[model samples]
Target: MENKDHILLFRVGKSELERIQQKKAEVGIRSMAAYLRKMALEGICIQLDLGDELTEIRALLGRCSSNLNQYARVANTSGNIYAEDIKDLQQLMTEIWDNQRALLKRLSDI
Candidate 1:
């Protein structure tokens, strides 16, 4: 990758700016812009720490899909299906279907 210099702007008190310069010198960071960016990135990264959340969501979706298919088949076959029960199962299936469509759309966009 090509390295490019980007101009950044910051506002700080005189004392704070002096402290920053002193620390940059101590760390042998000659360019204030580079030094500030490096230190700021070290302190915070945005694309963070979602492995557990992703795993949990995956498990939940798997279970929901399995139950949805099972219930859908039962509702289709069972001769004495109550209206409310059928509606409930259909709603759950529809919700899962909608979520799947939305997920696919987002993946395609990405």
Candidate 2:
């Protein structure tokens, strides 16, 4: 017969601990030990660079809002709107939607 007797332990700082928890949550893993084991064995980690995409989306939304507000002001003051402005707004909205869709697809691929 064989007996199993072993223990493993380690210490991590508050920030390091928080980062571990965050990674677990991001990977949809519930067990901390299992997550660490898998990472240690397989050397697998996911690092997403979503900041640029988010920034671009935010800027696009800001532009859309500003353009809409300008259109509203013009319509209110003069009771008239131009076709070119409407077309430009539509183009901006399309770009925003397209970028959002791309981001979603990238996330799904992960």
Candidate 3:
């Protein structure tokens, strides 16, 4: 994302400004511009840690994919596949899917 260099302004009554401050406090948002932008554009705004979690999940899946590729190479070179390695890979996949489902459910709640 680019830094927001543009400016936009509007006037509001004193009471309206106070109300906006109160809402920002209640929402625990520190950035007035960000809070206002979300309120104006989205109608409803929420703060969720899902972005961080999803990034972590993506990293984990990348590692899992790398490991799978490594195992495939080993199997091709050795003419063998280990049952235990397959089970471990399956378990890892299952856990990743379960986490994705949970995250989706949380998003659906919003």
Candidate 4:
């Protein structure tokens, strides 16, 4: 590690401090000093807003899991599975892949 011996002190208003803290949390950085240091040196931070994409992916996964459970129950009781049930699962999987690809594309653009 490089020597970080110098101390830089600064002051901001209440709202400014809150904004700084919010940005730090958004980027998943725990240390305020480290976050401020990086921002000061780099002068730019790229924060991706992926909440919607991730939420959609999570919903798709939940549906896929529920469908699998239902299929398993039906197969266990009747020893038969329908083609339509499999098709629905495949469609859910395809949607998940599409969302993942879009997310990846956005990340790559960043």
Candidate 5:
């Protein structure tokens, strides 16, 4: 490990500080010093706006979870599971995989 024996200090304007804080939050970094150091050293931060993809994934997962719950309840009470329920789950899985692949492709492009 490298020993830290030096102090590097700098100042930023109010607007600049606000921008830094905003970017830090966007990247989910809690330490301002670390964020600044990373920016200074790496000089490249790729912030992907995955909101739409995440929302779609969440909706699909919710539907899949609801279907699974219903199927479980039916099976518990009736002691039998339907082929249709299994098919629905398989279809949901396919959609989830497709979305994941699309997201990966987008990330790889970056």
Candidate 6:
């Protein structure tokens, strides 16, 4: 109906044009351009969320790696786990050690 006010018909195939109209109705959009804009905005939002998620994951991993190292140092120096964090830190160190040992041995051989 809005197209009646416009000079351009856009000349798309029947199926494609129908799909565009269907999506426009589903999104409660008033025009084809608005539907297209909504689709583009959704795509951009997904990519932004993915990037933020990856950044958070990397930050957590860095914190885990740092905490493991701190635990190893404190255990080696203090000889006792007086604090809960110290105990948890040691467990993290052990987990890191277990994971790295396989690679460490291979690297040492080379």
Q: Which candidate gets the maximum TM-score versus the true structure?
A: 2
lDDT of 1 by residue, 31-71 (tens): 98778878987855445444655565576577667766776
Sort all candidates by lDDT, best to worst.
Answer: 4, 2, 5, 3, 1, 6
Is 1 or 5 the stronger prediction by TM-score? Answer: 5
Q: Alpha-carbon error at 99 in model 6, in Å? A: 21
Residues 44-98, candidate 4, lDDT per residue (tens digit)?
A: 6799899999999999999999999999999999999999999999999999999
Those runs of model 5 whose alpha carbons end farther than 4 Å from true positions after fitting are 1-42
Cand. 3 Cα-lDDT: 0.87
Model 5 lDDT tens row, 1-110? 78868779989999999999999999998998888888889887789899999899889999999999999999999999999899999999999989989999999999
Please give the CA lDDT of all the candidate structures: 0.72, 0.93, 0.87, 0.96, 0.92, 0.65
Of the two candidates 5 and 6, the one with more favorable lDDT, higher being better, is 5
Distance from true position, residue 32, model 4, in Å? 18
The residue ranges of model 4 lying beyond 4 angstroms of the native Cα positions read 1-42
**Quick one: best lDDT, which candidate?**
4
TM-score of each model, in listed order:
0.35, 0.65, 0.57, 0.64, 0.61, 0.33
Q: What is the Cα-based TM-score of model 4?
A: 0.64
Report the Cα RMSD per candidate.
11.7, 6.4, 13.0, 9.6, 10.6, 15.0
Residues 1-110 of candidate 2 have per-residue lDDT tens digits of: 54526556899999999999999999998999878877887875789999999999999999999999999999999999999999999999999999999999999999
Candidate 4 residue pairs in clash (backbone atoms < 3 Å): none
Off by over 4 Å in 1: 1-44, 80-110
Clashing pairs in 2: none
**CA lDDT, candidate 3, residue 58:** 92
Question: In order, how many clashes per candidate?
Answer: 0, 0, 0, 0, 0, 0
Screening candidate 6 with a backbone cut-off below 3 angstroms (N, C-alpha, C), the clashing residue pairs are none
Name the TM-score of candidate 2: 0.65
Deviation from native of the Cα of residue 38 in model 4, angstroms: 10
Worst 10 residues of 3 by lDDT: 44-53
